[model samples]
Target: MNLKIVVTNGINNLIKEDYIYSTDLDFILLKFISNDWGDLCNEDKKFQNELLKNPNSKYEYRFMGVYLINNIKVWIISEYNYSIKSLIMTILLPEEY
Candidate 1:
């Protein structure tokens, strides 16, 4: 069975706060919604644009989920020290189960 992990802005923020990761994007896109999976895409346009534009600090995005109480929220996590993108990918793509 595939296990879905629930990630949230709070967790990401905490990671950054603890200095576990220095880079923190401004926005994240929530994509998936499942009690098991939680949130997925959480990146925003401006943050994405900055990631794409900059070459020095290459940014990478990953599908993540966050659990709130019993509900799950998905989000796209953006990782960059400075810069982001302007376009939202999941918005353009067709929804899949």
Candidate 2:
């Protein structure tokens, strides 16, 4: 798939609404587009267990990955739009998840 990225208006609104910090935007884009990341498994029992253990904890879903940027762990969420051949990625604060 030719995965082009589109940061939707919702993500932009998050930034504008202060749900996502402005400074981390570049780092999010860099890591998301990097080839060294792995996909998240939504059905993983271990992952589900952890989430169940802490409902307030932040987590990422399909095609998304948890990454450590600047010594802080961040979640990057990616939604693929097959119709447009694009992937929409949004970076969020843990609390925002």
Candidate 3:
């Protein structure tokens, strides 16, 4: 599986440190400072659903509650992750958060 990785803008100022979110179908590799990594991981799914509903919304990074990867549901933190080469695979957004 091949996942499309998109680099958002707001993240540039918010996080000066380097981080990456790579996806390959069902696998997502998040590379960031171990400390900041945990905060955005398990956010409320309700927030993610609302943000993704509009495919064209201006919202860049927030909280991607729980999503599907290889048929498994997992938490996705938007902040601290956005490098292409570091990407591993595609990230599947769940129908209902």
Candidate 4:
């Protein structure tokens, strides 16, 4: 996708909490940028697609992907906030949200 990968606060937390390997982190960001949606079910994937099609006021653009790391499930989310003129991406365990 020739996309720029963002390393967000949640990713920093993932590194500290899990000591996650670089390769796994690479896969997560790559999959996220490529729209691979790792472990998401069809319904969740559909929601991601819908979000892209119809973003809300809070987030001008957004995407979510689920992936498994050492048997632990995590979610990666990226959002563009028009108000702040920034793009933010995050990764964390679902419960953290």
Predicted model with the maximum TM-score: 4
TM-scores for all candidates: the values are 0.21, 0.40, 0.25, 0.68
lDDT of 4 at 80: 69
Q: Which pairs, if any, clash in model 3?
A: 3-90, 22-87, 22-88, 23-88, 23-89, 23-90, 24-88, 24-89, 24-90, 25-90
Alpha-carbon shift of residue 74 in model 4 (angstroms): 1.2
Candidates sorted by lDDT, descending order? 4, 2, 3, 1
Tens digits of per-residue lDDT, candidate 3, 1-97, equal: 2244443343232223433233422233343211122224345434544555775432354544333433444444443234642322223333222
Number of clashing residue pairs, candidate 4: 0
- What are the lDDT figures for the candidates, one per model? 0.33, 0.54, 0.36, 0.72
Error of 4 at 2 (Å): 14
Q: Model 3 Cα RMSD, Å?
A: 13.2
Worst 10 residues of 3 by lDDT: 31-40
lDDT-superior candidate, 2 or 3: 2
Winner by lDDT between candidate 2 and candidate 1: 2
True lDDT of residue 92, candidate 2: 51
Give the per-residue lDDT digits (tens) of candidate 4, residues 1-97.
1233455565567677875766897888888877789988999888777766653622555678899988878788777655656666677778778
Clashes of each: 38, 0, 10, 0
Worst 10 residues of 4 by lDDT: 1-10
lDDT of 1: 0.33
The weakest ten consecutive residues by lDDT in model 2 span 54-63
> Model 1 over residues 12-77: C-alpha lDDT tens digits?
555656732322222332223211222323454344444446554323443233333213232343
lDDT of 3 at 89: 23
